[model samples]
Target: MMRNVAILGASGYTGAELVRLIAGHRGLRIAALSADRKAGMRMGEVFPHLRHLDLPPLVRIDEIDMGAIDLVFCALPHATSQAVIASLPRDMKIVDLSADFRLRDAAEYRRWYGQPHAAPELQAEAVYGLTEFYRDEIRAARLVAGTGCNAATGQYALRPLIAAGLIDLDEIVMDLKCGVSGAGRSLKENLLHAELSEGWHPYAVGGIHRHLGEFDQEFSALAGRPVEVQFTPHLVPGNRGILATCYVRGAAGDIHAALAGAYADEPFVLTLPMGEVPSTRHVRGSNYCHLGVVEDRRAGRAIVVAALDNLTKGSSGQALQNANLMLSLEETEGLTMAPLFP
Candidate 1:
């Protein structure tokens, strides 16, 4: 049976990506799409590329008849999603693609986002939406908090090593590069063509990036102690994909074996041949995360690289994957499409 779904904030990049992926979904159908500013406008008007799809016109969140929807994808921004989702029908199955509920602690959320969480109760109930690592929890969760794109990429590269006790927990370092699309469709001078085109530079340098909160919460839990990684994210000149290079203290062969063993049975995550590196181009527009590992010239160190489409695997595609589990639909449904290439 087809499950009717609603997508809030359908005017943004992540929201539109949800529509794109859902277009191919056989078990889920878009019953309503909400974009406040674009209310009353056809989805095609806001996203010409999606014009071919026969979808509902954008509407105010309240304008939609929620009774007809089975689940909702909250693609709204951080604080916005919190309040909006808080007031939503308590029984509605939701997948929140925001930073609002990712962190388990309200104090931690306040410390990182610079505001008190509007929905502490919901935050406590939301399952962290890193599909591969938290499958069972997500399957039973009423609300799932999507992982940060950068954080997801880095974790894919390092989490297995951390869990298997293969890498030096104290010396882990991740340098990640993301495409401009991860910034969302918001207008900003810094993301303008004149400013960001043909250039790439690191932001949130040091330990200030908010995704650190997630890494801290998840890695520490897995390691049974505090594990702080030096994470730096750079914005690259591209439309999609994330490439994360993780430098860790471990043998190349050991790191390779650990990663290969961890993701061997997992779908959507592929481990490449040893000494092979993945390029962002390889996984663009798909739900796949490609990982590669190699030895560093300096003994006892390995360079592990991971590539994925931040908008796809890191966000909406992941949300959809979790939604599938929550709804008991085939896990791979609507997600089997291969990565698009030139």
Candidate 2:
């Protein structure tokens, strides 16, 4: 029996990605698609690349019949998803690709998003959807919140090291570079082709970026105390992928061993041979994360770098992985694509 899935905000980048992946999935069908402003338009009209797939016409969320949909993928904007999902049938499993339910604390949500959470009850119910770390939780969760792309990259680099106690948690720094699509399909003056084409610059400096809420929550929880790392994100001129360079106080060999041991059995995570770092181009358009460890000249310092596609592994693809778990299907059923290399 094929499961019927609905994609809210179907016109956005992540939503289109969901469509792309689902079109190839053998057990899932695109039953409904919603785009508030693009209602009544065919998905092909908005995303020409998806024209080949036969899909439902885009409609507003209110027009969707929840009875026919088994799963809902909410790719709506941050604040919008909460209100919309709140009104849906309580039993429908949701994989939200928005920031609304990612943070556990409502206060933290307000602090970063500048508004009280409209659905605190649902916020409390949402499981953080870092597929590798929260696999069991996601498998049983009714609502799963997809991680921030940059946060995902940094965590993949540091989580294993922190969990194994191989690094000095106090002296950690994460420097990340992301492609433009991570900003979403929204039109902004800074993301315009002319301005973003040939230049690169850092935004959200000084721990001001909202995704830190996730880093603070997940890392601190793992360390059993407060853990704060200097995180800086820069926008590169490319269209997809994220490469994060993490500096930690630890021996290079230990960092390599910890990562290798942690991800040895995991399918999507690849810890490269020591001293061989990953590049964004290698993991582009795939649900794979590659990590490399190298020793710094300073005896107690090491460099850990990770690469992944910001859109795939970091967002929509992650959402689909969580959805597969919640539905009791094989986790890697539809995510077998190899990275597209130049």
Query: For candidate 2, lDDT tens digit of each residue in 198-262?
Result: 88889999999999999999999999999999999999999999999999999899899999999
Candidate 2 regions exceeding 4 Å error are: none
Give the TM-score of each candidate: 0.99, 0.99
lDDT, residue 216, model 2: 94
Candidate 2 clash pair list: none
Clashing pairs in 1: none
| Model 1 ranges with Cα > 4 A deviation | none
Q: What is the lDDT of residue 26 in candidate 1?
A: 94
Weakest 10 consecutive residues of candidate 2 by summed lDDT: 327-336
